[model samples]
Target: MQQKIAVLGPGSWGTALAKSLVENGHDVRLWSHKEEPVQEINNKHTNEAYLKGIELPKELKATSNMAEAVADVDAVLFVVPTKAIRSVAKQLVAVLETKPVIIHASKGFEQETHKRISEILEEEIPSEKRQNVVVLSGPSHAEELAVRDITTVTAACEDLEQAKYVQDLFMNDYFRIYTNTDVLGVETGAALKNIIALGSGAIHGLGFGDNAKAALMTRGLAEISRLGVAMGADPLTFIGLSGVGDLIVTCTSVHSRNWRAGDLLGKGHNLDEILENMGMIVEGVSTTKAAYELAQDLNVDMPITETIYNVIYKGQDVKEAVRQLMLREGRSE
Candidate 1:
């Protein structure tokens, strides 16, 4: 069945999802904050800044007007950054005439509140105007998905029927969707894995071979699972797509902004320089701070996350941090 879907955000992920929806035969309206990208997507069918070489579906229309985008849409996919979720949700409240299946593809926490993206959405968007929220996350990257690479992700919602509806809406030959009821586990895994990806990039940037990278990834997963369990998430979810799956892809892929930023840091560039150079949100940077705070509050011993926090926020040298990490007291795995 064909439906009208509005993709809020014209970033790489948003554009790729819009393209997928268009391929699935839905009417897609991609919303961009800026006029230039909106005009480019509308007139030229491409988003050069995010997806440089890929061409968007010409049928994927874009607009800057919030009212027009949400008007009568069957579903609204929030693809914006975590920091922007509250503001966007407020905007949606103003224009949304009917309750739509609200789905978010963003993967990060609110730095100020240390709340997950779904939590922020629920807090900002009134329950009367929005249905139960769904989170779409996993190992998929925008660049790979835009080119129709085989990708799998999970759709998590408290409501199984709603999750299955989303599963049917997005499932295709190139993109596979799995449904889960563990929203807490899925969202926590999605947010925390970016920190591990940053660590992975740093390991590679420091000229460490696969052995070191593998160690970091393994240890990183352990700590992530620890934190997730403390926060009421399923322990097994850490081994699943949103957990180890996302950690592997984001840490290893050049398409990951977090890993790229960490790579730059490993190569001796500062965080400010990295952010300026990339011109895109390296979610792990902010997420590192939030996760660090959460770990401290929860009394979770996340040494890797602590090291990343110090390296990024405390002006600690990457090499020195790694040395300190290696010198820590041994523990049984």
Candidate 2:
């Protein structure tokens, strides 16, 4: 069963996902906003700017024309950055036909808007097909995914059948998929975990050990669950693939752009220097600001998120932030 799929954004995650679907025998039309990435994919079957070492499937057609990208597609996979989803979704309105089932692979809440990626999509996509929205999230990283490393993830949607459809379309011997109904929980977990991963990386960069990292990861989850539950999500969803699962992988992996950014910050490099050098989107960087503001607005207690916010935006010393975190009143877990 060959399905025509449209994948927007040609960054690491977007390219990896397009490759994954293409290898599974789907006809994938991948759209890149930049002409260079599109040319590399169409002519050489590679995304030089992002997934450099991996070869993309020849069947994965690359297009700069949005209409050509979405034409006759059975499904659309959105892999753009959180901050960029709104504008991309707005543009998609012009190219789309009968609305395709939309799957979002992004993992952060919009900072100024405080809206989830799916939320932004809902506004741009028709209301009649809102339930068609599905979120694919877990511990999947683009680099390993490109090399065919075994990966597992959860697909969440309000419609069980829709979730299963996505699970069937992408799952393979190397990739296992699970389905759940808690879309909000899954998306929130994926977005919020970036905040804590940065904290763990900061501790790691400051010459900390496993104990410190563990404490941050554990307590960090408590905050994520608190916010999720408050926002009408199923509480148990936080324990699932998108929550604790993604949290662990992002916090521990050296490949996480968010954590690596924090590591440089903890080691004394400024945010401007780190961003200029990385030349990529660190979802956790802006997400920290967004989550901190969200916690305050919702009256949620997220100490770790707050302190990191101070270090990054308030220009507080990283060591002082660490000391302040330790000096806070200790309570029983």
Candidate 3:
């Protein structure tokens, strides 16, 4: 059953998802602020700016106007970064018609406010207007998905029926979707894995072998689980595709911007420098601050995240951060 779908935010991941939906036979429309990317997708059937070399379907349409995109859409999938969700939602105030079930593909919690994307949507989109809100997350790399890889994920929402509906939209031969009731765990798992990916990149930058990177990834999952469970996230969800599965993919895959950003930062580059050099939005940088603060507030021991925060924010040395973690009071795992 193909439904009219509007994917808000035309970043790489957003565009990739648009491609997937179009291929899956949905009436897909993409809206981006930038004209070049949209024009590229519209005129040439390729998103050269983002997913270079991969040609999108001619059926997929691109527009700069939100009014045109959201008109009678079945679902409004939010794919923008955490920092931009509120502002974008505010902009959608005039254009949104029925608040078609929001399926947020971006991962990460908001800074200071400590709100998830679902929370932000609930507050922004009115109750009467809202459709089912679902979060689709897992170890999915947009680059891989654009090429039609077998990517599996969890569609989670407070409402079970809502999760199943969203699963119906994105699930296909190449793209598989599972349903989970723990939206907090699914969202947290998606958000938190990037932090570990950063740690992996830091080790990679320092010329460390697989063993060091492996340690960071595993222990990183532990820290994420501790805080996520404390916050009412399902403990088992952390072990699923959105948890350990995502950690493995993001940490090792060069396609992940989070790990790549950390790689540059680990090699003596600052946050500003890394962003400028990478020329992309690395969600981990902001989420690192949020998670660091979250750990402090919740009294959760997230040593790996704390170390990355120090390296990125407090101008601490990466080697020193590693040494401190190594020398920490040892206990049984």
Instruction: Give all TM-scores, in the order shown.
Output: 0.99, 0.98, 0.97
Which residue pairs clash within candidate 2?
none
Candidate 3 residues lying further than 4 Å off, grouped into runs, are none
Q: In model 1, which runs have C-alpha deviations exceeding 4 angstroms? A: none
Please give, for residues 138-204, the per-residue lDDT of candidate 1 as tens digits: 9998999999999999999999999998999999999999999999999999999999999999988
Show the colliding residue pairs in model 3: none
Return whichever of 2 and 3 wins on lDDT: 2
Model 2 ranges with Cα > 4 A deviation: 128-131
Q: What TM-score should be assigned to candidate 1? A: 0.99
Q: How close is candidate 3 to the true structure, as a TM-score?
A: 0.97
Q: What TM-score would candidate 2 get against the native?
A: 0.98
lDDT of each: 0.93, 0.89, 0.88
The model with the greatest TM-score is: 1
Steric clash pairs (candidate 1): none
lDDT of 3 by residue, 47-140 (tens): 8767878888999999888889889888889998788899888877678886588889989889889898999988998877768689999988
Could you report the Cα RMSD, in angstroms, for every candidate shown?
0.7, 1.2, 1.1
Which window of ten consecutive residues has the lowest lDDT sum in model 2?
Answer: 123-132
